[model samples]
Target: MYDIKALYEATSVDDACRLLKEHPGSQVIAGGSDVLVQIREGKRAGKELVSIYMLDELRGICLDAEDNIRIGSLTSFSHITKNPIIQKYINVLGEAVDQIGGPQIRNIGTIGGNTCNGVTSADSASTLFAWDAQVEIAGEGYRRVVPINEFYIKAGTVALEEGEIQTAIIIPKKAYEGYKGHYIKYAMREAMDIATTGCSVNVKLSADKKTFEDVRIAYGVAGPIPMRVPTAENFIRGKEVNDENMEAFAEKVLEDINPRDSWRASKAFRCHIGVVMAKRACEKAVKQAGGDVDDRTEL
Candidate 1:
């Protein structure tokens, strides 16, 4: 059981920030999906919870005047899966969040909690990394935005400050413009199982749609944080979207990922699956980008 604690329901973003500033030991809760489990298992220390579930300001999905898609931190996985804006702009993200958990978990689990939880197995992390997403943080008197790639410091840790709360996630227009992407998760079971390894690939094709103008590849459970394979991406960029080049790209992934042995899988097994998932995700992304790889030569 969780220890006794005081519960404060925050009515707005400002109220949540103020409560966090006032109570240094307090923890913020939106969906209580991750924090509650941690508290009951004695993994999280704080007993005071500042609930932001009632703060409607931190919920929704919309495009700002700047053309960046801004998703409020409290936006639930279920909402994300159904948001037309998300499906139209970055459907791969929708695909990633849709596989998070069972119906109940997805209905109440906030994207902020999943990102902030900072686990390598977080299904949303790799996709956000691939999309080059940015996180908007709010505190008592200041606000800042940072690239999602820089958000995670290590496993179960993030760059969030003492009293700052993530307000929204912003996907810059450049990240998703003319891009088609795909996400794939490998696990022992289809649902309710943590990812053994997951991969996401976003490819922006050339005008002719036969070459990869730009590519971003990210993997989950491949390291302490969501793994973005720059070496692999660099190898694939500007290359013809064919089976041979894709195989080379997948092999290059070994130069970046640093998986570890754990109860869920061995390091070697994780690395193997990471490479396999990368190739599969890239193929799917190519298909989504309106390219057919079946006609290409096998390497």
Candidate 2:
């Protein structure tokens, strides 16, 4: 059985923040998919937990007055995958989260927990990075926003301050408009296996749909944190969509990733697969954006 000191049920967002502030060292629990497993594994065995699962304010998807897509932290993977806003605009994010575990896990696994756990192999992390998402946080009487890049401090770590909880994930209008994206999760098995490497790429074609106006490529399990290769993105920003440009862009990613040798896969294997995923994901993303790229070319 899992060991825990106590559980405090929070009734609202303010209540949750108050509980977090009042009970120092208490861990926040929402959707328990990650926390419960950690507790059972003895990773968080004796810690006090404050449950925010019932906080309705932290659960919805909407577009704010600024035209940013605001996704509540408590939104489930299943809910995000089926949301019309996600399907229409940033479908790559939806597709990425959908590949997370099985149906039951997706139903209860929240995007907040998935992100806050700070696992590099998380399915949603890469896409969020690629989309230039922002993390909105609330603590006591203050709220702040952090870019996705700065939000991730390192492997299994985020930039959350004491008593602060992530309230929403915001995808700004400028980040998603005119962009088409794709996600590829390379895993040992197709069903419920975790990703050995996950790649997310998005492209915004020029008005004529002939050249790339912008590109973003990110990878999970590629380094200490899910990160985008700005060097590669810069190289392909104004380049014509073609086999040569795609290959070069994929090669550039190798300079940024520092995957290590692990039981699941070796460092060399992860690097090679990461490049292939990048190329393929970019090609698919370009196609979805109505840009012509030679898909028959092999790396």
Candidate 3:
């Protein structure tokens, strides 16, 4: 049996915040995709739970006044992939979350839980970073926002306070405007296995479609936290979009990533894959942006 001291169902966002404040050691549970599994494995045994699964206020995707994409924290991966707003604006996010697991897990795994868990290998992590997403948090009497890059402190750690809950993930209009992106992941088993390495690349091409106006690239499992490769991004900006420059950009990305040795992959192997994935992702993104890239390039 699963160990639990108590369970409280929150009726709304305010109720969820109040519950967290009232129960000192309580943790919010949505979808139970990750929390329940951890509890069964004894990692979170005897934990007090604040169930937010029924809070309709915390589930949907939409655009705010500024045209920023706001995704409710409790929105599940399956919902993300099917959401028209997601498809029309940030399809890279949908594509990234789609790779989380099989149909069942996608049905229950939420974007909030995926990001809040603070794992470097979370499928959503790299794309969020590439998009320069922001985390909106709510607590007893205060609300604040943090950039996705700053939200992740390190492996298995995030900047969330003890009583705060994430409300929405915001992708600023400036971050994704005039850009298209792609995500690439390498895992032992394609379907359900955790990613050994993941890369996300986004590009904004010049009007003539001959040069990179700007570029953003990020990686998961490349270090202790999901990180952007500023060195590579800088190199690609204003450069001609051709195979020679693309290959150079890919090599420059290796200068920033710091993958480690693990059972899933070696530091060397992850580093190698990082370069390959970066190039492939960039190419796909460039093509999406109408840049001149080979149509037959193997992804």
lDDT of each: 0.90, 0.91, 0.91
Candidate 2 residue-wise lDDT, 1-299, digit = tens: 88999999988777888988898999999999888998999999899999999888899899999889999999999999999999989998899999999999999999999999898999999999999999999987789999999999988889988788999999999999999999999898997999999999999999888898999999999988998898899888998888888999998988888898999999999999888888999899988998877665333
Residue 177 displacement in candidate 3 (angstroms): 1.5
**lDDT per residue (tens digit) for residues 184-241 in model 1:** 8888898998998889999999988789999999999998999799999999999998
Error of 3 at 295 (Å): 5.3
RMSD of each: 2.0, 1.2, 1.1
Root-mean-square deviation of Cα positions for candidate 2 versus the true structure, in angstroms: 1.2
* Clashing residue pairs, backbone N/CA/C < 3 A, model 2: none
Question: Given candidate 1, what's the lDDT at residue 68?
Answer: 97
User: What's each prediction's TM-score?
Assistant: 0.96, 0.97, 0.97
Better of 1 and 2 by TM-score: 2
